[model samples]
Target chain A: MEDPMPFGTALHDRVRDEHPDLDHLVRVATRSGTRIRRRRHAIATAVTASGVAAVAIGVAMLGGSDLRSGGEPDVAVQPTAPASHPVDQPPRTRAERAHARALRALQDAPVYVDSPDWRCDQPLDEKFICTHGAASVVVVWRPAETWADYQDPAKAGPETFISDVHGQFFATVNAGPDTTHAQVVEVGEALIWAE
Target chain B: MITDAGKDSEDFGDFVRATGTQLYRQALLLTGDHHLAEDLTQTTYAKVYASWRRVSRADNPVAYARTTLLNSFFSHRRLRRSGELPTDPTLGRESSAPEDDPETRLDLLAALTILPPRDRAVLVLRYWEDRSVADTARDLGMTETGVRTRSRRALQRLRPLLGAELTERTM
Candidate 1:
């Protein structure tokens, strides 16, 4: 029996005859991976610098507080301690507290990678790249204040949530087929890129 | 040792060779112009290549590619609201005569261009791809009811623009 709608099939057949050069298409596809990898690296470097600065300020405050209290400053002490502990001591400034919180949250956050073989290079110049063979993934931090100032909250997904203490925002990007938009959002929440 | 990245490149190259033409054809219909169709097809392949590891492992890689192509098309349309025609003259000229009567084909392409991107997508998936209503709905991220409604409306919209001669060809 003949199909009732021959026009659709005819149109499809006609269009199919117009073939494009396969080599050109393949070249473009291959190049896109490199472009994505470069962009991800740049973003990761920017985010890591801010994270490191926050951590340094947090350490300075702890050391300063310990010295003023006539106690030996513990370099390895966690920054989760309250800023208003000593009644006679001056309280930490708002910026100090925020940095402390952000650093703490980032330390506790999970790292998400797309694959097990991917490994992050040691932080050098506040930048690191997680690589799996030739593919690379980059994770970056964007503070909530910065995100809110620039981005529309309504468009952001749940993964775009900021840390309760420091108001830090994070996002991830990579040059891989599996690094989808939803996966990027999930990476933002975890602040780690693997795969 | 053959690296994973090397293997990925080889596999992606093969996939593009096998499916590039079919995808370009679909893009040509979707865009109604050759140059735009080529750009759209290339972008789709690039996205598929970016997620090659996962996409290749999918149960139906062809369907995945098609979905990617449609999403790319709609996103481009949304980003650029202009109805600017292709600047290249040589593009639309090549396929101007697909059948004995060139007028019918031209009219069909014209009518398709008039429909909104989403509406055109619904019709193409339904008729050209011969996809079921459920599949079309899932592909377009619309409800089955919405697909049916859009399909009916798009056809009605195309019917008037296609005029009497081309309308009879569909039936």
Candidate 2:
């Protein structure tokens, strides 16, 4: 019996012969590039405008004499907290402050740990683990690190704590002396940051 | 020295002219429809053009282009789950009413449409493009063993549809 190479070659040749001309491919590609550039420019403009508007609103709210009557001048605005919880009088205990900060960082994250018994535990020096039912996340507070360290956690050092939930693994790593980053990575999926 | 942007555009245009037809052929085999194949080819070229600076610098740009094309095809397939070419009974009847040299080719393509996208990709890359099993695995983002298994299974599936004449020699 002969090899199937001839048959495969014939098939390839037929398909190749049937392909239409490539004159329009370059045109389509150029148009696509233009479209992408326009999209990026529009997004950037929107982001910049939003940032400016937010800053203006913030300044207008804080600079108004009525809003700043009794509060400390040095403290920035804390929009998230209730009116009763002033920025100048943050949680007094270090653990409470850390927990608050962790909650703020993860406020916009897609996944949430929904157990009623969730508690943050400091198992190691400057390391906190919060668990609720099957879901748990560990946050490590580093003193002074660069953003690059957060981007490449593998180079930062060994993982302090790792927890697996729903086939996704979460790890906390010291990015720098002052920087800590938490990341969740699932197999065949992109790395998602908890920041 | 040419500016980077000018050089990138020129290189991309040249690359498209050089290998566009071959990529279109591969797309045709993968899609089993001429229109879909053309769309896939154009999309692939557009991606390559967008990433021209990096892709043109790659050691094997052809392989990179092939990988990009396969990725575009698979992603397109994923986005439109029910949008694959229809294999209705009427179309099957029309396809069975054979012509001369085109009959065997149409039969081969018809059989190919039954396999899953990844399996079809494996077969086309292995047989039509004559890629090594390792290369096919890498292109499909699968293990070598996975590629082998898919290739064997794809051939088995095709044998019945393709009949003994086409299946006997190579597969």
Candidate 3:
């Protein structure tokens, strides 16, 4: 038998001989010509319409009170029922429950904890201690309900902020330096690390 | 030499005209069936057209299309749950046809069928398409080292299936 041939040369020859054809497959690109042109036109029209709408909205918002007559505000104060609890949200975790308890316990009172080092920058709750780093910061807890009551002077005495962290509502109270404290606060079920 | 704002249909047509035949041939080599090759080519182009705007902007549109086509083949196999391998009937058909003395073309195709989908694709990209490791890696969504390792393993696997003439020669 003859000597065996070189694999690279043989493979190269084979590939060169068997290279795939190109012209026929592009036929569809030619076939869909009309549809493509129509698509481009539609895209252009949509973009122009969006630009016009944006300009109109910007002008109206900027015009503000000047655009309206000296008439009563159109704010409607209809009493609508609160939305039902969402069914899609997953069940709360253990950490989340603990966070809620911590937040509710320190609404007005200053709760404190100390830590050496921490990784995350943002505060977890009203009082947060950096267990990982020597750094720490105090957060202010301004409960929305309490703030609203304060704004409405007609309402009764100082509203208490201390309560169950309402659905994903928690705060961080800002205390003086030299104290590294973190308060594990929760809102409904969501947990936050206030420092 | 077409610009981004070139006529969409004409550009797509040009792209297909430029690359379709080679893609069909590659599909045939991979699947070892004329009908399957045709279907693969049609499906590949349909997808390419669907994303033509994005793909055409890529540094190497041909490479992008090649990856899309090969990935489609693997995905099709996965959906069929045929263990991602050709059934015995298809294998037998591929082996039986064009059998006389086994030319290099036949040898390469046969050896390729025995390889796993990814390996087969690696060989197609590396040797057949003349793509560099970096280009192949980008197309396959793998690292350059990954492409090299896979290419080496595929070449090793193919050696046994090839004739002594091909097996003995250094790559």
Q: Which model scores highest in DockQ? A: 1
Interface alpha-carbon RMSD, every candidate: 8.0, 10.8, 15.3
For all the candidates, what are their Cα RMSDs to the real structure? Answer: 15.8, 19.0, 22.2
TM-score of chain A of 3: 0.25
The TM-score of the first chain in every model comes to: 0.33, 0.28, 0.25
Between candidates 1 and 2, the TM-score winner: 1
Tell me what fraction of the real C-alpha contacts between chains A and B each candidate also makes. 0.51, 0.39, 0.34
CA-lDDT, candidates in order: 0.60, 0.58, 0.51
Ranking by DockQ: 1, 2, 3
Per-residue accuracy of model 1 over A5-93 as CA lDDT, tens digit each: 75576567557568899998898767754444444564465456545555755786878898899877656544332443221132276
Q: Which tens-of-lDDT digit does each residue in B33-68 have in candidate 1?
A: 787788778777877776788889999898989988
lDDT of 3 by residue, B1-171 (tens): 866545765777788877776787778666655655665676677667767778778898887788778886874443222223432323322332233435535555556666777777776777667678898888778899999888878767655555444543434
Ranking by lDDT: 1, 2, 3
Top-scoring candidate (lDDT)? 1
DockQ of each: 0.21, 0.16, 0.14
Q: Candidate 3, residue A61: CA error in Å?
A: 19
Q: Which candidate achieves the best TM-score against the true structure?
A: 1
DockQ of 2: 0.16
